[model samples]
Target: MDAISLCEQYAAEHGMQQKNGNAPWRLFFRKEIFSPWHDAREDPIGTDLIYQQVLHGIKSGEYKCDKEEELASLIAQLYYVEEGPLEVNHLENQIYKYLPIFELKKNKLANEYWTGSIMYQYRRQFGVNPPDVHHVKESVVSFAKCRWPLLFSRLGKPSRNTCTIQTVSGDEYYIKSFNSQKIEYLILAFLNGLKQRSRFVIARKNQCGDDSNDLLDFEVGDLLELINGVCGKELLTETLVRGENTKTCLQGFIQSENVYVLPALIKPNANVMIYADNRNDFNRSQEATAYPQWRFGRDVLDMPLLKKLEGRKEQCNDAMTMFMFIMKYMGDHPSRRNRLSTDITDVIFKPAIAHEILRDELYCQLLRQITMNPSVTSEEKGWELIWLATGLLAPSPYLLKEVVQFLNSHQHPIAFDCLNRLKKLNKGCSRKFPPHFVEIEAIQNRTMQILHRVYFPDETNEAIEVESSTKARDLVCQIAKRLRLRNKDGFSLFVKVREKVLAIPETEYFFDFIRNLSDWAQNINVENSMLQINYQVFFMRKLWIDVKPGDDTNADLIFHYYQYLPALKPISRRTFGEEAENGNLPSHIKNLHMIRKPLTKYFQCEIAK
Candidate 1:
């Protein structure tokens, strides 16, 4: 007589928020508060370590709670909508923060769906006149109370030797979907009760009748439908459908009239149970994961970029030419040099390697020079030989064995320091060799020497001097600050490359947006001059869902309205006469609006002037 529920029961139990109402899901995260149990008036504990450690553990993916993805989705729904619409697409980054690298890779596509799922919730709260976002679904679950219940019936004794159940309700399963086997086992436990459920059970293909090939993918929906079949104590051979329809029943019977030998699937004395929430549960485990791999960790982070190599790509004087760039850089930094970005390194390596300038032979030649040449062997000019391994040679695993032998037999300080550093790098028994990782974000970048122009919807513009590495949000914030716009969230920077319009992500580099246009335009059949003239950057209101009237005095609100007004598609235009009859005309009419420029002059005037 076992009664068990997995997701539903657990979620309902943990649904209660912390004692402090401001907190979100308890299991999702629980920040520590000063408790009465501890009597120190000052609460010697520094800034709520109890809960913060939980956050850190979860962020690192070391700590996990039941229904982790479900909890993450709930937390994401709660916190993500707090930002503007442009930032909504970037919630994938937030998902990474709360989920493990393994979990993110497993469900890499979840963000594309979930973000839009929660859009309606924010649209209501923010009166968000959101610019067109990528693939937002109309159905929103933000700020809405959700219920997750674990429903189950008490187990009854089997009669006539046919013990089984079929059909299940999908709604009660708190976790909408589960990827791990542990969760599958939990579903089985919930279905059969902890006492009756074994490590696993298999449904016989022959016993399943005509639709024998179908198996439930362990969905709780069909699992619960079994409850409908299991109403009474008398067991029945229920019809188990698959996929859109399904059933669950225990295999406890046998046919004495059939041929003597038992089949391989079921042991002679054991039950021939049939399970499956959907058609693929039996075959699901055997299939390979088709999702994208977004796994990230220490193994993937770029060390040089972390230490230095940001914008230094340009510092290698332009005169070095593609042919001698690597040589000059290596000669100058004879020692370890700062890591350069991939774009810069690719240019240097691609050309040099293509022309056989920095080939395996040249690398081997350098090794021979350092170890064999009489003057070098005598320890004179030893540093110059060591410098030969700088940027280009350091990355390769070549001559590692020879370097080890030289260090073992000889005592040369230059090789001992430089080659040893090189040796320490190649120490691991790696399968793929040195470059098994990507560079991390650089420490910082230099300031740009030029001013960038931001254009408004009305065709007017302002020029702002920003850092070379400034991000989209920073640029928007600068515009908002200068204009005294109190409402900055509704504004976004839209980049028009030729005819294509792209909204720059909030965290992306402002100049990188311009650089990307140049990069992609290289493939176009158009002229370089055409590419340069086609792209224009501007600040405009892309989302007009805001219902709040603009403030007359706040430049922020005025700027927001000026950009937002032109985009109104006018589903229903309210004429001034209609507004007057309705007594609403005075509101906008009272303000002393700025003088408008004629379209002829507006079109000709420089946007930034």
Candidate 2:
């Protein structure tokens, strides 16, 4: 018959209906048959023709099998045929001559989908009792032994057809087969689980082992212990059984094949069953517990900078380059000035790495820029720079000094903010300041006073120089001696400078006196007397005070002259007395006092000569 007629006959016998001419169904049918024909016109045989040829070839003895009955059964199974099996002993004998046993086994396993379909059909047709569960389990175990000898041996024996495998390091797995047909499925599932959930192991050889106790001999049956993670292969594995009791754990990779599922002789424990679920969590907990205990125990100063920078070369270089770029960009872009500020306060100036960055001159320059940029400078950034500079005080004194000087002149709030920072930096630093630093401190004190006036106007208006009561007392004593006050007891020294009267207590130190004096000096209505006291008591201590007789007033007129001036050239007394009486002396020096005799003895002697 023609191929089309043959297909019609087969369909009639099977009571099969043809599918509609849908593209999907046609495509699916062509794909299922593995047809080479791409289109209806390419090869007229098409999908239906191919199916007909295969069935006809089988029936006509063109195809052969080892067992005619089995071949017929398989063919009928594939075609959904309902008929007695074909008999062909001669074909069966011929087939066996060419196919080996191993090939047969491989082919059977390879056609798993067909085998599954046949089994389903058999169950539907014969209503077979579930193959003896015990027999199926035995078959699976036997297959496991052949396929995975090492893994099977580790499983001592099966309990209720279930196996529990425990590695020497305490990892556990359970394998069970309750149904016959699912044995291969269960084994496959277990293998997949093993691959997904396996942990790494490292092994090292035992040095004391004799020639007889070779490394290979330290196999599954040997005892082993777990240790810290190590790098390398062939090291002892945590799960390896050791031949002898020793303190060391083997370090190495445990071959998955070497792992076995021993038959569970008893029911599995709850903990063993829950192992898979909690293994990762338990591992994380172990790492968390162990990490803090592992200390490098090396001093920071002892660590070589080059060695520390070895693996971090790229990261450190990138960070430094990026920081420089940001600074350069900030300088050009005034509107985005705060970008540099944010970087210092939020990133570079962190306590952990701030010192490291400060050690670099380039980074110090960036810090200086951030501190001085009025548009972008903030109290926080200023403090951060101060902190970094303070740390650099010992290693880079010049850089620290530059940073302080820059901050001292900065109009930003940081100008004031760095005062406390420097104080703290200086504390406990034991290092002596360079001569220039004393001047720097004076400048800082003056800057702090200005900042105090601008930002903290309401803050207790006190003098920056007045730090202690002793300094305040010293200042008062100087004023007393200058005024020749013999009755110094119970007499308060009232300083009239501008509109403010600073009552200097006798017990007050020089610091308090200067502080109060500074406040008094800042008054808008300051008098000439106050300006004179400010210059002489706080400043012109070494200068000569020239006392000239006044033309109109009985009081002598005092004028501050250079200490280096010769007494012979002493100011013409006649000229200064008339000027003092007319109140023509500069307002700044108008309130000068008569020279104390003993202090001005040199000038007096010069005048006498």
Q: List lDDT for all candidates, in order.
A: 0.38, 0.36
Predicted model with the maximum TM-score? 1
TM, every model: 0.25, 0.16
lDDT of 2 by residue, 1-609 (tens): 365566666666776645752112122231121211123334433424444433444455444455533453444333333222322443333333322334346664534433443444444533544343333323322332243334222222333565455453477776664542244345444543432332222112223344443332233223233224321111212223322221244333332123322223223345543553344222212443365222111111222222334455554564554344334333322333423223332333232233343344333434534431222223233344443344323334555566566556444454555545455545433212111221224333444221111001112222323221123344445443544533223323344444554454545433334444554454544553223233222221232234332321211112223332334344545547677678876642554334333324555455556
Error of 2 at 204 (Å): 4.6
- The segments of candidate 1 whose C-alpha lies over 4 angstroms from its true place after superposition are 1-323, 326-346, 349-448, 526-534, 544-547, 552-560, 564-609
Clashes of 1: 31
- List all candidate RMSDs to the true structure: 32.9, 31.3
Best model per lDDT: 1
Clashes of each: 31, 42
Model 1 TM-score, all chains together: 0.25
For candidate 1, the per-residue lDDT at 544 reads: 42
Worst 10 residues of 2 by lDDT: 450-459
